[model samples]
Target chain A: MTTTSASNAGFAHGRALRPSSKVLPEHARGHNRSLVLQTLYRSGRRSRADIARETGLTRVTVSALVADLIADGLVVELGQREETRPGKPATLLDLDRSAFVIVGLDLSEHSTFSGALLDLDGTISARAEVALAGSTGEAAVEKVVALAQQLVDQATVPILGIGVGSPGVVDLGGVVLSAPNLGWNGMPLQSILNARFGVPVLVANDANAAVLAEHSFGGADSDAMLIKIGHGVGAGLLLGGTPLFGSRFAAGEIGHVVVGTDGGAVCACGKRGCLETWLSIPNLIERLEEEGDAARTAVLREAGERLGIALAPVVGALDLSEVILAGPTELLDGPLAAATVETLRNRTMAEFHGSVTLRMTTLGQDIVLRGAAVMVLSGQLGVS
Target chain B: MTTTSASNAGFAHGRALRPSSKVLPEHARGHNRSLVLQTLYRSGRRSRADIARETGLTRVTVSALVADLIADGLVVELGQREETRPGKPATLLDLDRSAFVIVGLDLSEHSTFSGALLDLDGTISARAEVALAGSTGEAAVEKVVALAQQLVDQATVPILGIGVGSPGVVDLGGVVLSAPNLGWNGMPLQSILNARFGVPVLVANDANAAVLAEHSFGGADSDAMLIKIGHGVGAGLLLGGTPLFGSRFAAGEIGHVVVGTDGGAVCACGKRGCLETWLSIPNLIERLEEEGDAARTAVLREAGERLGIALAPVVGALDLSEVILAGPTELLDGPLAAATVETLRNRTMAEFHGSVTLRMTTLGQDIVLRGAAVMVLSGQLGVS
Candidate 1:
């Protein structure tokens, strides 16, 4: 399926991205600083004067912030600009990609714990993975730490921070409240990583991470939602550019919502007729194995319809425009994708709305790692 | 029914209230100005230095902003505050509640077109209502204009703006895309009122307006959903203190979401399983009239459970903590409320998050009008 993932702020219609007249003076300078850095990050190399003119900041303020960035090893003085439409040739400043590396971990992979060392621009510099062997508790934690350490050791530059995307609900403080697959309950992942490496750490739900990755790198419309249907089903909702952490940080747990209603198959959550039971890859594959090729498409289409049923109210309530799915594209595309779009259109109020665009993930398997990198970038540099 | 309506930003957990470090230099000063005004609006009265301390603004900046407010007639200098700390007594500044009057219209009231003139603090200064007699087309539009003009004529203070909360799917630009009840289709409400009154005007769906009113006047949690179940069923979603007016401005059209699986009554939209078909007050009342007291409770409870099923994924997706039902307490409380809560618990990811608190609106019947008042305030002055 053709995917349309623009910036998260696109679907928000200038709500989240628009700066209002309700900020304080204390935050003004910081906001300007972040703005300057964001422009530079998004636009690649730009001179101080160019940034000043673009951001409408005084040359002096931009120069001062640039100085601070360079002093902090974030920006580097590059060669002179082309000197077009200026009195003098201005020296361009660039994000020093080699100065810092971020360690990102994706624990959502069913049988493996994957890690990657990413540069400032989210380029994967090094990679590592550990076969999980279906371990939980201390063993799972140990495997995660080992994978992180391997990526950390492989880093060729200063480690900016470490971000882990685990399966389950996570609190604002990066505490893993629960991960059924990992057998994790109230795991202090951030503290553990922070203490182990003596670096800043952020741990978030894998689905939330995937959404962040989509927003930062995958071109998600600002107020869009990302649903990841692998071994487990969960959603990542981005309102404006920021993720909706919900009141309890369990905002994106859509897998266990009852979809079958009349109780078909029992789910791992001890519930009959859950969304996960209908849509999970393992369950679908199992169902497909018993059916013919023609029946496979029908089964996947039914699963897609079920998924759409579970999400229709959400789309109706939130008016989220873009619904992106991430998983094995083969099973998610064709008849399944068509059925999902049909169901969504059938469910939402199409009189006022056109139709919600359905797309497949562009980042694919590396979505979580890139999302974790984005988490580190937002937490450490205040930029996404 | 117990009601809990805290300040709108309370449930947002400082997300919308906290000034982010991503604003532009052009918006910084305006932001600070809004911040100072918002503080005064929320905290009642405070001195310049006190505002500085609360807002982290310099004394000179606060004094300058306050002076501007006073000049604009949006604020007034009150008597000196008592010297609690060791310093000279400071004159306090307060929002001039009588400086501006907002005309608010509520079209959701069954068989009536109600209008009110409200002061800056949302106090109803004058009220007007016309029994609709189930009118539509040009007649309905004429009635709305007459009611608005009556409120405008009664305004004693300077009129700030007019806001209309009509029952429909309104686009972000204040166009009534569709209002089945009022026989409206693509009505340019904001433009019509603006041209007539020669002042600012905001037009929104009644449910959206109700949510906005809840957020601005009734102290709704920033991350909350308000379900307005009267003659029709609809919802208003507040994400990060702003109304979620989906990409096509159809964010809260929840009533039409398919709810009944076995295909019962057909909806007004030609759907057989819409939530509105099962849960609209008129339908519930008719069903109650046929049943005994025990059966009445069961019917309401079943309706509530169906509503909850339609909303569970939304609650799970948004992780919203506050769910407020706007309608008669007689039909919504007791068994209905309990069933809704129970269904939400059974459907949401309770393994990680706690139960979402469901409550009746504290603003009662005036929610849409109050919401219209809030729309005018936010549009004119960017407050709340």
Candidate 2:
């Protein structure tokens, strides 16, 4: 049961849950390799026979793939298992976590640049961060590079790839199309980092990164949505194992959607009554301080309702059952999330539908960086 | 050049278009059948070598598969193709439109149950309809059955399957979980239709069917979305070729998302300022009649803005570049669509990203029935 749950969790983390043969029939060798790697990474050490049985791969295929992975320094053979059910004790295999480390950058934070060295399991090996001091453009880019370099220097094994989660509309090429907060416009962050470190680098939107982290490392379900409500608001979507990269790679930009049409406060994007004006942490805090306590309570509740109004259609359209809010838990988890759940239930087919779960993100602030790790793992090593 | 254009169209229609070697790996035989059939269906008649070349399937494999298809009556051999090349003229093949006809039902439109016999290439052979004169429940269901039977009997070729596009929340099992318009709740439409007709049956939401039609037969882009603005307001989402069938089968239920905060019209669902109140055609028509000619245009514009306001986040969240409106082209294509496009540009990343296209559906009122055909083609025949 433990192994089964772990596999399920790992399935959401990376790759499809169904057997490769049943789900997709075109991929041959690459599919086999990913299945083997993901199995070892998620379910812990297992003998070749166990991996084969779990994945529905032939034992011969698993053994050969495992041997190749070991030779490629991705997997390693361990000592015999101590389980008492077998006639002969079999040697176990596991992902070689120490064989490579990934550099993960969280650039979506409000006032700081943070980077971490993450192992195969998405655990932080070391961390380096710096508060921004009036930097923009190349100056800010230099600061981010310095942070990544610090983490890169701390790597205790072969460097896999670097993954950065930044606040912007990132293209498939990892170009920062826009991030007003970070003062980046068309910055080729992936290429910059790749050239600076002479290694593969992947850059994604911070919310996309957080959702990826939630999906690949934090056991988020398929069709789950993670909304990061901090200084800004955005969302990351996972429909099954695939991240919904919209036509323009702008999926999950929920902040600027005009809501609460009574024309409340305006947003940075020059829109009135946007979810940004209602849901951002700054706006929430301002309402809390400027208005009375009743207003404070009311603002959070109203903001949650507005969010629910925006999401009700999405949930109705996508049949998404799980929604996770990533921000200050104190701010989002109380009346805000409760009101969101209430509004969503009232607006959608709640009676006829399955229960929709709304909860705070378990990973807290480390979500973006770990998501960066997930991107690197999946992009470079074929496993998350 | 014709062959090339056809390949491009078919490429947009089916198979994993990304180098075929990655993403989806396990749909081997299914993939090949679709590739070959789509090429023949869209590109018109072509020699076996041309299909093999376009699909990247080996000539021997294409020959063998085409031979099986011809035997199965899905393909037919035409006379030899004339060519100026030095080699002997090759035999051309085409999809046998008369070999097997699909029965497609459109239950989305108001006051009628319409069905059609569709060819393999999605061309309508014949149509049948029964007006619902204030009938509902069993009476309405009986009329729908009669319409389906008329079309089923009109299908001169071997019947492929029956596909119904109903206005409701359809489950994976083809049960109509809810359809207030038709007075259906938890109706086992698929099973009932299958038992009655003795053929495979598929029941999908009308919007879902329309989007599937747009994706499979209408030359839609990968991240295309089709919004059906009939008596009801809903959306059909296609991320690449995958339909977004949300967790509760409520994906595309956009009508009830509360839009206006200034207490306007109350929805039947007991929500104020719902997209339903603002966007439904009846509501729009009422506003036009209540206000004057200026108000007629203004209401449509405002409705479009409201629709855009709801979809800005979806476009932002899903990065959908192309959105099609399925309704009266005269109404949706003019000021309404323009206003929606304008509002979306005003709210989303307009300057920093690629342009978003908003246009009326090319399929007109027949989109849903054709979409039903797409469901059957993909489900029973595996060749959408």
Among these predictions, the greatest DockQ belongs to 1
Question: Candidate 1 — what's its lDDT?
Answer: 0.80
lDDT of 1 by residue, A255-283 (tens): 88887356669888787788988899999
lDDT of candidate 1 over B63-174, digit per residue (tens): 8888888888888999998887897898988999888898999988779999899888888878999889888877888888888888888877788888889887887667
- Write down the DockQ of candidate 2: 0.38
Worst 10 residues of 1 chain B by lDDT: B1-10
Q: Tell me the spans in candidate 2 whose CA falls farther than 4 Å from its real position.
A: A1-26, A82-87, A292-295, A352-354, B1-27, B287-295, B330-333, B352-354
TM-score of model number 1, chain B: 0.91
Query: What's model 2's lDDT at B54?
Result: 81
Task: Give, for candidate 2 chain A, the lowest lDDT window spanning 10 residues.
Answer: A1-10
TM-score to true structure, per model: 0.90, 0.90
